[model samples]
Target: MFSKFVIASLVGLGLGIGVGSVPVLQDHLHWNIWVFVPISGLVLGMLFGWVQFTCSSLLNLRVSTRIAFAFGLVSALAYLGTDLGQYLTLTVAVSEPTEVLSGQTPIRQLISFPEYLRLEYGSRFIKTGTFGNEDVGYQLGQVGTTVTIVVDFLACFLVAFATALVMDDTFPWCQACNRYQCKTTSTKILFADEDRLYDVLDKTTELLLEQSDHVKVNAYLDLVAAEQYLVKPGDATQILSVTNYACNQCDNKTMVGKVLVKTGKNFSEAKDLDFMLSGTS
Candidate 1:
């Protein structure tokens, strides 16, 4: 648990520094390093963690390093697959169009009229060669084809190589390697914070009681104290509860009031803590 907090803090700190130092990331996007570095780190860390756990279980690998390597390789392949899919879908939409306007093709074909005719009438157009009918759909670009098998082989090799380099040092118990644990601990902290809030309110009540006279203390003051003392993550309902009580009293007396403003601001701050605790963006 302590390690998770330390890891999250470090990730957040790194983000702050990276965002601040990187002129391109900051200048072009008009976003501070503090805004993106920790945010990006946390999100990336979670993504890596999830992939590690799922792949490890599926492959029955006990080593975190192996899982990270496998997932990183898969990420590379996914990137390649996405790129290839887009290329094929856009370049070879001839056969799959639902609104088949039979007159003319909307996209310019890669195989122009000359190439089409050459293949259509070539004398050696024997039916069993590399350019055979079985391969015709691919040759005509009727179906999308990925890069050559050689290129694909190289891609997989490179993916596996890169994965091994980057993730070979990871440990299963490391905070950087497991996001599920981070989320669980963060949730526990949030709930714990909520449970401890009543004590804070009680202390505030004791102080207010000391200051007030024999006359009834205005409920609004209690609400104000609640909002001001809400320094921790959990128990946001205290803010709403106190604010609602104050609002009800104010409404009956037709008094000028604004519990909502205080509550809204505190709510926004409280919301950030949840993400911070979760080690997620």
Candidate 2:
């Protein structure tokens, strides 16, 4: 577990540094750039969350709020690292020897890091409008900069946090084997009868439980049923989704069931229909 944490931290740090350098380099090259957008921060946070999830899945690391908090902190540090990289690059490119406050201390180094960060944050501005057209611009000052930093950091942190929570709640795990389970099979049944949704879901769940208990039994009947229902010509109002998961190292297996209601062209999960059943093969 400790080794997994160490690995995740190292990976996150490297990713942070690598990603944080892009904007700095872009700005240095005078490219058309905008880096302080909240959406950009959310996207970056999701990327970090994905990497963290991949690492955890590969390492069989347990997901928890503690782990999520650590990831959030690392992500924030990565954001700060981007600013630090920008500041250092700008200082090096623009500061001359005569710009030093003392004998050898550069003027940029004279102030504390936080003060420098505030100044940098205050210098950023947002512009909205079409390209090659009139645009409206808003620049941040002391208070606005502080608020923007807080809001941006919170937005990024919340995304990473929520991603971790979703993984913990939805991903199948084998408690006895102390590892994540793999999805072995998934089947969906479409039905148009809204009144019979629960009845069909219950029957399907019962069939799954029975099949799961007798691992030696052939699943041909279930597949035939799925095919029969899927090929029906009429539009489906609700879908009964079933998925099976298993642990390779043990006999532990899980069956998950959910109902999704068709909304226009997409299906959304129905509340109170999600369930999981575990048994030994």
Candidate 3:
């Protein structure tokens, strides 16, 4: 994220300077024009990050490819929003104050790429100078537009990469753990089905074995039986579950009871219960 932001910002600033002014004295241009001109380039560059984070958070999506795509798509949409914002400003400028005051607030219409590109260069070039002596300004405007497009595209790619890194640990890697050795709250909360949860609970028995300063692990169900149940909230779709987990590590072969709760779009491990199975298999 940092790299993309820095690189795009530099490119935008360079383009802003390169295209906003004219060259004088052979390849030398006055540095005066750049003092206040690259503000849009810099702000919009950082705005992309905020846009991605906002979109991802609103959806409550854990770090994943889907959320990453959502961020990139929204960032592109925001890029277009800037063009819409520009169009609205121009629209209000050309309309009378009476027209603006009456009726409703003006709705901004999104502009197409070709039209935006055309307007961008057209506005910059046409405003640079009066007709005949504007060739240099026209060329500079074209260069600036090209640079802007390139920088925007590069920024999009970088935001996608950053999204991947930012969201990588939002969800558990359920497939990596063997059923005989582990279970996760996600099996009850985040996942779509309960079969995997039951399967893991039924099979989870073995853990790390430490013997004579050497430790090894194996997979086997414990020699005990357990009871499980699903709890439901009143009129709400809360999917809660209680399970008596057989813990072989205990010297008395004591069982552990686990409760899981699903709240809205999130899942959590609830407080442990005193309930446990009494008999050993």
Candidate 4:
């Protein structure tokens, strides 16, 4: 768990820095095209969430809500830091001549950080025009800047929070083996009788679970001959998908079954028919 947190924090910080720097660079080149849309923040959050999920999966780390929230917070803070850093660099380091023989003057000498923030944010920073008319403008004052900051942070937080939770469900882990299960085989059967389909799936799962060796499990699976249940898609009312998973380092195995019912024009998974079984190989 500690390792997971450390890795997540590093990843969040790195990603935030990489993303935040792009806009600053663009601004320097006078080629900035960033539009502060809420949806853009959501998309960025999801991208961050995906990176976090991928890292956890690769490292075999279990992800929880707490870790996800921490990652979100770190990412948001790192991104905000870029903005503050840019402001400070401009105000404190960059100097402008006051007048002839006067001296170099830095913006820091005239305004503090808080005052600078209020003045800069209160000014019109973004403006867009259509063919010949002004179409959009953003002149968020101090109050609006505060609101925007909160909204942006929340957008990054909530989307990442939800994304991590959702992706975790798609992958199953073996607690006993302390690893992720690998899919060994999968078969899709078109069936007319739901009872027969269930019986075949149950029997297959039982036979595979009884074996102690992966080779034996594979041989038994072959004998089941799922192809015999295949039929034309147009003639089938339901489809049963059976997937087998096994832990490579141990004799643990799992079988997942899902049934899809054909509706008017599409097939939808039947939640009632979903089942999972786990046992020794």
Candidate 5:
């Protein structure tokens, strides 16, 4: 949906603007040109869009939170580092830099000559790189840099999008299966515990979750669903238990779950460690 795009783009814009405003990125890299912000925004928007699109896998809350944060962190860094990142990927131009910049070790200067540096539709940006300059730069010609930018942004967009659904309140629990699941699909009963959250939740989950789900227990006295979900990925080493279940309708999990117990090895420490979901009551 466009919401994802908008969120990612907005986040990208904020990050790109912030990172681009940094002294090192704008000044040291000499990306202070008018075209730089849009370019950076485009990259960030596409990068984040791609990361969140196809990569969204339903994961445990703790793991999903980390993954979401990872998405933002990578987006920020990537937006800040697109200049050097592209160059380091062996994208240097065939011709050497003709303009020798003084003052700062500018990567290269954008120059235009009537003959060799003619500005045409095909000609947008003249890639320049000095052999020994750490502070690299790009010079824009009157023709402007658009073709490479569109292509580059498209590339970033295509190679993007992956996330996990954690702390989801929209979904419901499977009453027949004795687990939290999506209303439309019983195939999603699998869950896992986030290793990092184990210590934190171990201390707090009991204290915080001991109360009844029906009781208005939140700080704001909101009537919250009293439920916990446990998922075991192929890599899980522990088990999870829950007391409440949402009203989401899904397939019966008994057959599939039995199959899991019968054939699956190296599973979580315990099977059905918690009470079974009450039948449709």
Candidate 6:
């Protein structure tokens, strides 16, 4: 298709540009002014283009400029998001507790004890040379640093280009979507007599929970428990049927009703039985 061709061309162009910029990037990676940084985008473009061409042909989709641009944009955005996410996780170094004084009396005497305390939000405190009079309050200000504007713009451009090349509406598992979705991998592609996907999910969830903070673990445990109760083992037919049946009920009442109708009053035997899972009914 014409669209496919455009995608291919743009990807090729981007890849060429990126390949052209590598030496420049190498030169500036260690420099003071970031002179060679511009080439990173070009390199990213070229690499994205090659990937797009290979995958597009496999999927039987035509390469197009629109596709390339869309991929590029998405890729750039994904990179940007990842960068920001890393910054958020890593920027804060140390935190300490501090108490604030409450209201004082008219005579300049202390009226009440401190009601609350503040802790640094993973931000660091720096020690600079003391002045004639040292101010303790000014130390927290040293922690927050702003990311450069040039870096942000470059990230966006790369995201847009990469997104265009790699995204496909049909693939639900793609990270391009705001929701947590995953594409069906080879393991999931072929249907077998027994389904091991839940086993995989269980292991993955366990690993994730082990690494998560207290608050996150609590929330994740609740969700994982709920999901476990809803899932059943069987062939694809049973799995699909159960999934569809659960999805169709609008509320707890509806879900209960559906289960009763389908399971012939065996719903009482179900573990972790909750109407909330079916829907709002």
Q: Which residue pairs in model 3 clash with each other?
A: 63-167
Per-model TM-score versus the true fold: 0.24, 0.74, 0.33, 0.62, 0.25, 0.25
Candidate that scores best on TM-score: 2
lDDT of 4 by residue, 1-281 (tens): 68876786677666655664564452431112353455545766787777887777667777777777776776566555445554444523334454532353445566776886566546435566555665576665666566555666678778877778777765577898666777788877787666766776676566545643445544544554455445667877788776888878787887776889888878999988676767774
lDDT: the better of candidates 4 and 5: 4
Q: Which ten residues in a row have the lowest lDDT in candidate 4?
A: 26-35
Q: Give the residue spans of candidate 5 off by over 4 A.
A: 1-9, 27-145, 161-281
CA-only RMSD, every prediction: 20.6, 5.6, 19.2, 6.6, 15.3, 22.4
Report model 1's TM-score to 2 decimal places: 0.24
Candidate number with the higher lDDT (3 or 5)? 3
Cα lDDT tens digits for candidate 5, 1-281: 33443454455445444544454554333222344444544545454544442233122122234444555455544553444332222122435444553343322233322221133224344335555755355555544555444444443433332222332222343435434453322222333434433443343334344532222222211111112133325654443323333333453321111112213565433443322322332
Off by over 4 Å in 6: 1-36, 88-91, 97-281
Query: Candidate 6, TM-score vs. the true structure?
Result: 0.25
Pitting candidate 1 against candidate 6, the one with the higher TM-score is 6
Query: How far in Å is the alpha carbon of 104 misplaced in model 4?
Result: 18
How close to the true structure is residue 178 of candidate 6, measured as C-alpha lDDT?
A: 22
lDDT of 1: 0.33
Candidate 4 error regions (>4 Å): 23-37, 78-129, 133-145, 182-244, 261-268
Tell me the number of clashing residue pairs for each predicted model: 4, 0, 1, 1, 16, 45
lDDT (Cα, tens digit) per residue for candidate 1, span 41-79: 233334334444444433333434443454445443333
The regions of model 2 sitting more than 4 angstroms off are: 23-37, 84-119, 130-136, 208-211, 214-234, 263-267
Worst 10 residues of 1 by lDDT: 180-189
Off by over 4 Å in 3: 1-46, 91-117, 122-139, 160-164, 167-281
